[model samples]
Target chain A: MTDVRVIEIKKSVFADNNEDAARLRSELKGRGTYLLNLMSSPGSGKTTTLIQLINRIKDKIKVAVMEADIDSDVDAIKIKDATGIESIQLHTGGMCHLDAEMTRQGLDNVSLDGTDLVILENVGNLVCPAEFDTGAVRNAMILSVPEGHDKPLKYPLMFSVCDLVIVNKIDVMPYFDFDLDKCSEYVHMRNPKARIIPICAKTGEGVDAVADWLLEEVYNWKH
Target chain B: MHELGIVFYIIRDVKQAAQENGVEHVNAVVMNIGEVSTIVPEYLTDCWRWAADKEEMLKGCELKINIIPAVTTCGDCGREYETVKYGKTCPHCNSANTWLLKGNEVEIKEIEV
Candidate 1:
């Protein structure tokens, strides 16, 4: 009979990834690159918001975009066509989230020589993506008006982890019965320090605030 | 939802541990999954079965889970309560300043060889 030897290895599954994320953050800091990990559900207008926000801030800052999806280059091509900036597509090969290692690999494909900021459009998943840190300087998420205000209470982890929350498609708020005040309150309940910005990407309303926020973050990262 | 991805992480860690210990095969991998850690044990084990069998060292390796009950501590009244029942708010003082003390773990507790 073979004896079973138990070996204690008490470590969180995310421990190694957290360490990698930290290392990647410091590396990006040294190179004067600010990475923003943007997460949301599918059809949350993440791409549209990015296009609006990117066009607003492109001239002010040297920017790049990395679009990560299960499979497709549509977002990558869209960003490039709209903003004419360096945008790359990263296929997760069926994975629902991007970890630090995957983010590093995507960054390798990007030209970071003079890039000030790299916006990573993460897979449109509110659940899995929140569990993995992608070595970004800050984390942000978009919650469209149609998704309801209760998302924060449901996906607490996602809301808690993000530094900023953008409430998109606010132009249709009147038709959808989406309460901006209640959404703010719920978001604050999940994350006290999270900054909430309401925007209508289609009309370019409230997008300047997001662009200004990014510019300020990039400036802070530099000096 | 991402149990398969987590299974891959577990495999990577277990393989590393096995390599470090000079073990030929791992008999089982014990995990401490918190009640609120958001991982479904059934899905994790199911994914493990599919992914582990592909690895020579972890073939037929059992994945055992130890559920850790989620607890929350209220800052306003200094009371502890079950996280799953009450969530972020404190039941005693009805304070919203409560924080999770434990039960968010998704840890590899040990490996049996």
Candidate 2:
């Protein structure tokens, strides 16, 4: 029998990705580009909300978008056609989430010149995407009315990591059993500092607050 | 699906380690998966068997998992408890201000050659 040797290598698998995220954040800061990572479940109206917010802030701030999905460029094409801005599609090659390196590659494909903000629509996954940081200046998620208000308790990590939680489909809240007050309370239970904004993306109700929040964030990031 | 991505990361790290140590043909790779890390061991091993075999050096290599139990510490009560059982609340003091002390790790422990 041949002699067997053991090589010790105790290190977190997320360490490299975390380091890369930090480096990418600093680089984006130097370039005066604010990156926002938007995450949610599939069919959470991410595209509609983006279209609403982008139309409000595009003239004031040079905005671009990176839509990440496992396959298809439908989201990218939709955003470009609706908002008429620079938008690119990133296929994760069957991966459920986008890591820092993937976010960097997507940024490279977009022209960052004269661009103040780049919003990355991450893969529609609450679990895997929260585990990997995409080097975004801030992380936000949209929770629709039909998904129920107890999601914060179910997915604590996703709620805790996000800086903002957009409660979309408020128009249908009366039809569904989603309680806005209870939802806010649960969200606070996970993260006290998280800002919750309720809006109906289809009717453009309460969308100005989201636009204002993004504008303020982009301004603060640049200055 | 998530485990497959993690398996790729493990393969990359192992390959780099082998290159640095001037070694070839890793026999087994050991991983420390925490209880609350959201990784299923069976899926991870399945992905490992599929992906690792595709690599020349890691072909026929075994992926061994060591599960670490999750523990949480309460800030109000100043006590530790099982994370999976009590979750974010401290069972001792019934305080919601508890944080995870351990068991969120997804680390590579070692490699046998």
Candidate 3:
């Protein structure tokens, strides 16, 4: 005798996560808060830049953070110290990239009822983070002066998907021979529509421009 | 190293496909991989051996990757060619104005049950 058992499993690898991200996107939009998913390699000054940005825009914009870290809460602590704004650290444990599910889980822990912005500091990796969108309306790519200018080509996906390119750590441009023009050219080549902003996260250079851009993005979104 | 993640996705997808087709076990899975995607096929298969070995639905499943040409289309010349040579500049026109046409694909194509 032959027996037949029929089981139905409808799933995409990231379907559940993507659904969660979609819901978060809607929730953030409803709360009148803009979301930015920040991505970069380790030591690319994403955190430092965030601190600098908070110094300038904290009073003007209500900001929150969803920090993705593999192990430590050091970055979350630093962001809180810099801005005094409440941030929820989403610890990935072993995950290299923060998927939509984790970000939504982090959102559940945040009080976004009256926030103006939520910046998700993605795990320090240039590749996978681009593939998995966390439902953030915008993604910012930070390429530090020390990481060289050829990053856009090698990590094209990350740069191509980014709405903004932050050339961080530009204060030390005198010491390192980083080709600002070449970096922007590459960024433009990959994505002609992307905005490239150069800033020094540590020295507070060109931060207001970034804040201005954020204001513009937020204003544009609301209308 | 991230190939492990891709493999898990593959295993998960194949199991679903197999179940939907009412198949007891999946025999093989075929994927269309772009040359420029960060995923390494060899590493993906290597990770698959361990992750899918114990699953009854995925045991002995074969993984196949279809290579997609890494073509970049020049804005000026309007020509496309395989520029898998690593650099972004177009080899034909020597123009950095080209955009990627393919080679960044990462998708499952087919599965045999």
Each prediction's TM-score versus the true structure: 0.99, 0.98, 0.89
DockQ of model 3 vs. true complex: 0.24
lDDT of 1 by residue, B1-113 (tens): 89999999999999999999999999999999999999999999999999999999999999999999999999999989999999998989999998999999999999999
Give candidate 1's error at residue A208 in angstroms.
0.5
* Clashes in predicted model 2: 0
lDDT of 1: 0.96
Candidate 3: list runs displaced more than 4 Å.
Answer: A1-24
Arrange candidates by lDDT, highest first: which order?
Answer: 1, 2, 3
Model 1 - which docking category?
high
C-alpha positional error of residue A129 in candidate 1 after TM-score superposition, expressed in Å = 0.6
Structure candidate 2, residue pairs in collision: none
Q: List model 2 lDDT by residue over A10-100, tens digit each.
A: 9899988999999999999999999999999999999999999999999999999999999999999999999999999999999999999
User: Which window of 10 residues has the lowest lDDT sum in candidate 1 chain A?
Assistant: A171-180
TM-score of the first chain in candidate 3 relative to the native first chain: 0.90
CA lDDT, every model vs. true structure: 0.96, 0.95, 0.81
DockQ of each: 0.91, 0.86, 0.24
lDDT of 2 at B29: 98
